[model samples]
Each structure stands twice: as structure tokens, then as C-alpha cells.
Target: MPVAPAPPAAPAYADPQGSLRASDADRDRIADILAEALAEGRLDAEEHAERVEAVYRAKTVGELEPIVRDLPAAPGRTAAAPRPEPVPAAYGPEDVEGNADQLLAVFSSTTRKGRWRVARRTNAFAVFGNIEIDLTEAIFAQPLTTINATSIFGNIEVRVPENISLRGTGTGILGNFEVTSLEGVDPQAPLVVVNGYALCGNVEARPKRGKWVVDLQSKIRKHLGH
Candidate 1:
């Protein structure tokens, strides 16, 4: 797929609700293809619905980051070069639909502003961008998932579900997180937690009971200048 030039600083279109239209076609193409899988019987009805929810409703790549980050590595897709800098300039979709077993993946970046949400879900999806999501209805996810994200000067509020295994968490100082259920971390998973200046976010996880084998934390220092 070809990358489109970033849209104007401010868009000219508006939806029926009278707000600016933040998204366009390129964002939905991958999701549309994922949706088509339903007719081909490659995805079960439930799977089809999940994928649809992930692709259509998710507003930006960040909000949808947890939506779809695991795609089967395209035959020609190369491995992402190891990042040598403390904060790699981006959180690119090195693995967009990069793995098969991993059902969903969302890829996006924020150079401006936008709004997105979950429309439907079928198989899985991929989200990437800088955007915000309002919690009106509900959002669901598959068993195994990966959401690689980066927010330069924006925000991402993820409404998580009950059952699922999370393996990775990474963030930068420029980013701030307000997770509601900090204990939601699935203990069955070998949770790899990492952050810079995350705030307010909490987790309510049903961690499998066991001996005290995992515990970790770190104090964050503020940057003197923006």
C-alpha cells in the first residue's frame, strides 16, 4: 500500500453532526478488505463482526492501536530495524497484519487532530494515529493482542474488555496515560511494562493467583522544558 500525503492542517469537510471530518478513505481500505473476508467464509460471523468494529469505529491509529497490530508478515515485508535511539521517531506498523494468529492491528500517526470509535468487529483490525474516543457503547478484543503506540502531544483513551492476555506496554515522556483498571493486567501473560511519564491510567485484571514472582515500578521525572 502507498502512503498518502498528510491532509491539510485543518480539513474542509464536515459530517451531518456539524463537526469536522477527521478521517478519509485510505484509513478504511485495510479494514474494508478485512471485512470482505466474511463473505469468503475465511472469518466466522463473530470474527467478522469484531474485525468490522475494530476497523470502522476506531478513530485514530493510537486509539485503534490495540485494535489491529498483529498481521501475518507479508511475504515481502522486512523486519523493522532495531531502534538505536531512546525514543524512536515513530511507532510504525512494522507488523501491520504482520502475524496470522494475532487477529487485529491498527497503524496511524498524529500530526493533527481527529475522532474515532468502534463500528464493528469480525476477525481482527489494525489502529494507528493520534485521536480521541468517546465511550458511548462497548469495545471488545480477541485473546492475544499487540498495540504499539506513540503520542507526541496528543491523547489516547482505551476502553478495555474483561478477558485477554497483554504482553507489552511502552510509552514516552511526551506521552501521558490514564488507565482505569491498573490491576487488569492479565497475570497469565508475561507482562512487559514500560513507561516514561504515564499518569491516571489503571488496570483491573484477574491475574492468575500465584507466588509473588512479579513486581515492578519507577518514579518519573518531569522535563524542564516542552
Candidate 2:
């Protein structure tokens, strides 16, 4: 008599009760579903944003289930294969050498904006002039970027996209040092840290309105011409 064939092994994280811990890939998949819903007019921008935020905050598969339970099933999504994590566009050491890491403005206004590669660390100095560093349309070479700003009788303003994280550890001496801290919903979003001093001048860091980083998966798909 022939023996019965062995039972198929369960898929990874195929808990019928959905009690397994969620991974980054899990969150990303749920986020993609929400994005599709928004695009189809099933969810408004506000609702989509809120659900995306929840997707990142979910710690378990159970928590992620309710986020898109009402949405239509995603196309081509299967449990047979695990979703791959997104790889962001990063600059290598050779690429870093080509990007400007320092900005100086002495008695003249200077600005660094548009589609530029940002280094891991940047130094900005403003003396009796204005220096503006806009990262709304910039490419992040790394996950975290530090900006060392110094203003002496001048001004230094740093603008970042609204969807990226922003932090400040700078101080003001007989001047103003202001930074509007923000925490982004996407875990893969870039982080900007501003640190330095402002002496008899102004140093400000804030999010640029109506500017945001595209969805990580969406960006990757576009790069692959999908």
C-alpha cells in the first residue's frame, strides 16, 4: 500500500487567528492597499493619510487586518511568496564626492534647491547674508542627514518636504533658532537633523507645504518601469 503524501507546510505568518507579529513588509503591503483605495476614490486623502499612519503603527498582523478589511482585495497579492522590502535610492561614496556638502553666504544671498543629491552631512554658514537650503525636491543619499547651520548677523533657512522627519538640536545666542519638528508616517522616509548655533541672526527649519515624498513602493515601481 502506498503511504499518503506529506501535508504541505503552512506559509510564513499564515496564522488563522492573525496573532503573529507584523513585519515591515506586512505594513508596506497594507499601505499599498490603502494607496490603491485612495486612488480609486474609495478613500479620501484625510482617511487615507490616517490609515497609512495606522499601518506603520501596527505591531501585529491582527492590528493590520482591520486597516484594509473593508477595502477590495489587492491584485496579484498571494501568500505563497513573501513581499520584498523596498530599497531606496541611495548615493554611494563615489556619488557623495560630487554633491556639495557645504554652503557659504557672506554678504551675498545663496540658495541650494531643486533636484540635488544631499550628502550625509551638510554645513551652512551665513554671515551678513541669507542662505536658503530647500530639500523639497532633493534626493536623500542616506536615511539620516545632519545640517550644521551657523548664522552670524544673517539668516539660514532649511526647508524639507512635509512627509519626511525633521529634528533640531540647535540653540540661539542673541538670535532665533526655530525648528518645526515632524514625525512622518512612512518608516522608510528620510530624517533631517539640524544642529548648530545662531549668533545675532536667525536659523529656521520647517516643512515645506504641499511637498511630500512619493510612496516608497510606488517610487520603486516607477524606477523599474512597472
Candidate 3:
């Protein structure tokens, strides 16, 4: 029998807490390593973008591994940020932006339950929350926006403007859905909807690019009460 091609080795992911011990300099060294890979074409631009984002988000060499998996090694890669020694400490959700590496953001609020605006940034982002979420303006600011949510457990709702494309994944379990500015959409850029068991809750997702993957396993038939 013929042998199959080897799979792409998974890169090492830095430890989640490695960020606390790493100085800005240390962070840059990590970034430089991957930047070299992107420039060499070992990894795609989107892959490179995610890797760069992870470096700032990462706190340990283990966390860096996944980021390191895709890039090609270059003969010479220079530093854009300084290198610092590693140290260890605790971390909080709000303290995330301080490492000079902010890939994802988390905002938890539950007061009046009013509409909230999604801030615009050049990077890729997603908003998953209850009914107190709105991003009509963000759709305009960013050409691409995504909403990955679970509504049955919590109310994750969002309003988007026209022009930008949208896609989705859901069990349609609770009232989880994605809305666009209009009904007419390009065949190439079709809106998607998914429901695994149509249970009580759902995991919804909509991204600017790339397809969503589902890997769920459960004995749902046994619970159907047949």
C-alpha cells in the first residue's frame, strides 16, 4: 500500500499565563519568528494574521506552539518589538489589552439591558451575548463582522447594516438567527443556517471569511422520547 502524505504538524501554543511573565521584548521575539514564516509564504496571510494576534494573546511557549506550527523559517528576520525576559504571575480579563497583544475582547455587562454598539477595529472580531447587543454601526465601520452566540442559555442578539456579507451556524434551538440589511444576496456569498438537534440552546457563528466546522457527538435520539 502507498503511504499518505504527513499532516501539517500542529504548532506549539504558548501557555495562557505566559503573557504575565513575558516582557514586550519577549513578545516581539515570538512575533518575529512567525512574521518570518508569513513572508516566506509557508503560511497564508489569514493564518499569519491569526498567528500574530495569538502572540500578544499568548503567555507561554506552549501557547506559542500552535502559532508556530504554520510559518516557514526565513534566513533573516528582524525585530519590530524589543525582547524581554520571562516571568510568571496572575491575570485578569480586563488586563488583556495591556500585553500589547489584543486578539479577542470580552465585555460582560447586565444592567439596563439596552442595545450596545460594536466598536470598529481593523482586526477580526466577534460578538456573542444576550439581548442587550447591537452593532448596526459596526457593520458599516468594518467590512466584515461576526456573531458567534448561544441564545437559549443567554440572549445573544445583533443588528447589522447592509453591504457586508454574513454567514451563520446554529441549532435554531432557541430564537438564534442572523439578519442582514436586505434579502437579496449574492449566490457566492450566501447566508448559512444550521441546527444539529434543535435542542434548547445553540452555538451560533458568523465570520467574515472561512467556513465553520461542527464536531458534536451525543445520544440525542435516546432523549427524543420516541
| Higher-ranked by lDDT: 2 or 3 | 2
* Candidate whose lDDT is highest: 2
- The sequence of per-residue lDDT tens digits that candidate 1 reaches over residues 1-226 is 9999987764444333424332523234444334333323455545544654454445554444333344322122353863222211111122334332212223443221122222322122223323333211222222122232333343443333232222223333533443332222222221111122222222111223332222111110121122
**lDDT values of the candidates?**
0.31, 0.75, 0.35
Model 3, total clashes: 29
TM-score ranking from best candidate downward: 2, 3, 1
Off by over 4 Å in 3: 1-61, 65-77, 80-132, 139-152, 159-199, 203-226
Candidate 2: 10-residue stretch with minimal lDDT:
89-98
Q: Against the true structure, what is each candidate's TM-score?
A: 0.24, 0.56, 0.28
Model 2 TM: 0.56
lDDT of model 3 at residue 52? Answer: 56
Q: On a 0 to 100 scale, what is the lDDT of residue 92 in model 2? A: 24
Off by over 4 Å in 2: 1-86, 89-100, 215-217, 220-226
State the weakest 10-residue window (summed lDDT) of model 3: 211-220
